[model samples]
Target chain A: AQTVTQSQPEMSVQEAETVTLSCTYDTSENNYYLFWYKQPPSRQMILVIRQEAYKQQNATENRFSVNFQKAAKSFSLKISDSQLGDTAMYFCAFNVGSSNTGKLIFGQGTTLQVKP
Target chain B: GAGVSQSPSNKVTEKGKDVELRCDPISGHTALYWYRQSLGQGLEFLIYFQGNSAPDKSGLPSDRFSAERTGGSVSTLTIQRTQQEDSAVYLCASSLRGLYSYNEQFFGPGTRLTVL
Candidate 1:
C-alpha cells in the first residue's frame, strides 16, 4: 500500500512571490511517478506538473516545479511568480510504476491563497 | 472532446436512492479511473479500468459503490442506496495506458453528488 501526505494545511503567498508546498509519501516500490494537481474554486482538477522517480532532475512546468527527492520520499511543489489565479488547493499524488495501471494515491491537499 | 468528459454536472438524491455517474474517456485512451472528492478534501481512488481487463475495485469505500466500463471507453459509477457520506464530487480521468505507460492523465469536470 502507498500513501501521500501533505503536511501544510494552508499556505499564503504575496502576489508575484514564490510558494512551496510540501509533500511526502510511503511506498515500497523503487519506481513510481509523482504528480502535483491543482483544484480551483470552479472544482476542476488540473495537472500542475509531474516527476518521474527515476529522474534525478526535478520537473518544471512554467511557474510550477517540483523538487523530487527519491531517497527522502519527498516531492514538493514550488510555484514561482504566484498570481491570484494560482490560489487553489494543491494535491500530491503517487502511482506505482509496476502496476501498469494509472491509479493514483493522493494527499489530503494544501490550500494556497495568493494575496494581492 | 480532447479531454475526459463526465455527465450530470450535479446530482442530488435522497438517501437510499441510487445514483449513476458517467465518464467518457478521450478516444484511444486505454485506461480510465474513477475518484471521489469530498468538499475541501483530496481525491479518493474508487475504481480503475484497463482495456478488457478486470477493473480494480480496491479503492471503493464499500460494497454500495460499484463501477463498470463498457467497450473500454465510457464508464459509469453506480452508488446503490446512497448515504449522506457519499455526498461529494465524482471525478473521471484517462491516460494512454496504465501506471507505467508514461502518459499523463486528463481529468474531467466531475459530477457533484449531493446525497441529502
Candidate 2:
C-alpha cells in the first residue's frame, strides 16, 4: 500500500512572497506521477502542478513548481509571488503503481494562507 | 469546454435516510473517480469506473455505500441508511483515460453532503 504525508497542517505567506508546502510519500515503484491540487473556499479542486518521477528536473507551472526528490521520496510544492487568491487548502496526491483505474491517494493537506 | 460537474451541490438529509449524489464527467473521458473529503482532512478515494471494466469498490468504506456509472457518462453514488459519519463533500474527477495512460484528471466542484 502507498501513502502520502503532508507534515505542515497550516502555512501562511505574505503577498508577493514565496511559500513551500512539504510532502512525502512511501512507494516502492520506480516510475510514478506526483500532483498538487488546490481547493479554494468555493470548494473547487484545481490542478496546480505535476511532476513525473522519472524526470530528474523539477516541474514548474507559472507561479507553481515542485521540487521532486525521488530518492528521498519527497515532492514539495513551491508557490512564488503568492497572492491572496492562493489562500486555500493544498493537497498532494498520486496514483499507486500500475493501477489502471486511476485511483489517487492524497495527503492530509496543508492549509495555506496568502496574506495581503 | 465544460469540466466535470456534480449535482445537488449541497444536500442535507437526516441520518438513516438514503441519499444519492450525481457526477457528470467531461465528454470523451473514459475514466471517472469518486472521492470523499471530510472536514480538515484529505481526499479519500472511494470508487472508480473505467470504460466497461468492473468498478473498483476496494476503497469504499462499507457495504452501505454503492455507486454506478451509466452508459459511461454520468455516475451516481448512493448511501443507504446514511450515518452522521457520512457527512462530507463528495467529489468527482475525470481523465482522458485510465491511470496506466497517464492522463491528468479534472475535478468537479463537489457535492457537500450533510447527514444530520
Candidate 3:
C-alpha cells in the first residue's frame, strides 16, 4: 500500500514571494510517479507538476517546480513569485508505474492563501 | 483542445436518494479515473477505467458506489442510497496512456454533491 502525506494543513504567502509546500510518501515500489495538483474554489483540479522517480532531475513548470528526493521519499513543491491566483488547495499524489491500474493515492491537501 | 469536463457542477440530493455524476475525458485519452474530495478524506481514488480492460473497483468505498465508462470516453459514477458522508466533490481525470506510461492526468471541474 502507498500513502502520501502533506504535513501542513494551511499555508500563506505574500505576493511576489516564494513558498514551498512539503510532501512525503511511503511506497515500496521502485518505479512510480509523484504529482502536485491545485483545486480552486471553483472545484477544478489542475495539474501543477509531476516527477518521475527514475529521473534524477526534478520537474519544473514555469514558476512551479518540484524538489524530488527519491531516497528520502520526499517531493516538495516550490512556488516562486507567488500570485493571488496561486491561492488554492494543493494535493500531493502517487502512482505506481508498474501497476495496470493508474489509480492515484493523494495526500490530505494543504490550503494555500496568497495575500496581496 | 478541450480538457476533461464534468456535468452538473453542483448537485443537491437528500439522504437515501441516488445520484449520478458524469465525466467526459479527453478524446484520445486511454485512461480515466474517479476521485472523491471531502473534509474527512482529502482526496481518494474511487475507480479507474483503461481502454477495454476490466475496470478497477478496488478503491470503491462500498457496494453502493459503482461507476461505468461507455465507449471508453464518457464515465458515470453512481452513488445509491447516498449518505451525508457521501457529500463531497467528485473529480474525474484522464491521461493519454496507462501502465508504464507516465502521462500527466488532466482533471475536470468536479461535481460537488451535497446531501441534505
Candidate 4:
C-alpha cells in the first residue's frame, strides 16, 4: 500500500514572498510519479508540478517547483513570488509507474493563504 | 480546447435518496478516474477506467458506491441510499494514456454533493 502525508495542515505567505508545502510518502515501488495539485474554493483541481522517481533532477513549472528527495521519501512543493491567487488547498499525490490502473494516492492537503 | 467538465456542479439530496454525478472527459483522453474529497481530507481514489478495460473498483468504499463510463467519453457515478458520510466533492480526471506513459491527468471542477 502507498500513502501520502502533508504534515502542514495550513500555511500562510505574504504577497511576492515564497512558501513551501511539505509532503512525504511511503511506497516500496521504485518507479513512481509524484505530483502537486491545487484546489481552489471553486473546487477545481489543477495540476501544479510533477516529478518522476527515476529522475534525479526535481521538476519546476514557472513559479512552482519541487524538491524531490527520493531516498528520504520527501517531495515538497515551493511556490515562489506567491500571489493571492495562489491561496488554495494543495495536495501531494503519488502514483506507481507500473500500475496499469493509474490511480492516485493523495495527501491530507495543505490550505495555503497568500496574504496581500 | 475545453478541459474535463462535470454536470450539476452542486447537488443537495436527502439522506436516503440516490444521486448520480456525471463527468465528460477530454476528447482524445483514453483514461478516466473518479475520486472523492471529504471535508478537510485529501482526494480518495474511487474508480478508474481505461479505454474498454475492466474498471478498477478497488478504491470504492462500499457496495453503495458504483460508477460506469459509457462510450469511453462520459462517466456516471451513482450513489445508492446516500448517507451524510457521502457528503463530499466528487472529482473526475482524464489523461491521454494510462500506465507507464506518465501522462498528466486533467481534472474537472468537482461536483459538490451534500446529503441532508
lDDT of 2 by residue, A67-91 (tens): 8989999999999999999999999
Fnat, model by model in order, equals: 0.69, 0.69, 0.71, 0.71
What TM-score would each prediction reach against the true structure?
A: 0.96, 0.98, 0.96, 0.98
Q: Per-model C-alpha lDDT, please?
A: 0.90, 0.92, 0.91, 0.94
TM-score of chain A of each: 0.97, 0.97, 0.99, 0.99
In terms of DockQ, the best-performing candidate is 4
Residue-pair clashes per candidate:
2, 0, 0, 0
Question: Taking the tens digit of each residue's C-alpha lDDT, what string does model 4 give over A58-111?
Answer: 899999999999999999999999999999999999999989977889999999
C-alpha DockQ of every model: 0.70, 0.72, 0.70, 0.76
Candidate 4 lDDT = 0.94
Candidate 1 CAPRI-style tier: medium
Per-model root-mean-square deviation over C-alphas: 1.3, 1.0, 1.3, 0.9
Ranking by lDDT: 4, 2, 3, 1
* Predicted candidate 3 versus true structure: per-residue lDDT over A1-116, tens digit per residue: 68899999999999999999999999999999998989898878888998989999999999999999998999999999999999999999998998887678899999999999
Tens-digit lDDT string for candidate 1 (B6-113):
999999999999999999999998889999999877899898898898888888999999998988889999999999999999999998887454578789999999
B3-104 in candidate 2: lDDT tens per residue?
A: 899999999999999999999999999899999999989999899899998998988999999999999999999999999999999999999887563588
Docking class of 2: medium
Looking at model 3 chain B, report the run of 10 residues with the lowest lDDT sum.
Answer: B97-106
Model 4 chain A worst lDDT run, 10 consecutive residues: A96-105
lDDT of 1 at B30: 89
Tens digit of lDDT per residue, candidate 4, span B1-116? 99999988999999999999999999999899999999989999999999999998998999999999999999999999999999999999999987654799999999999999
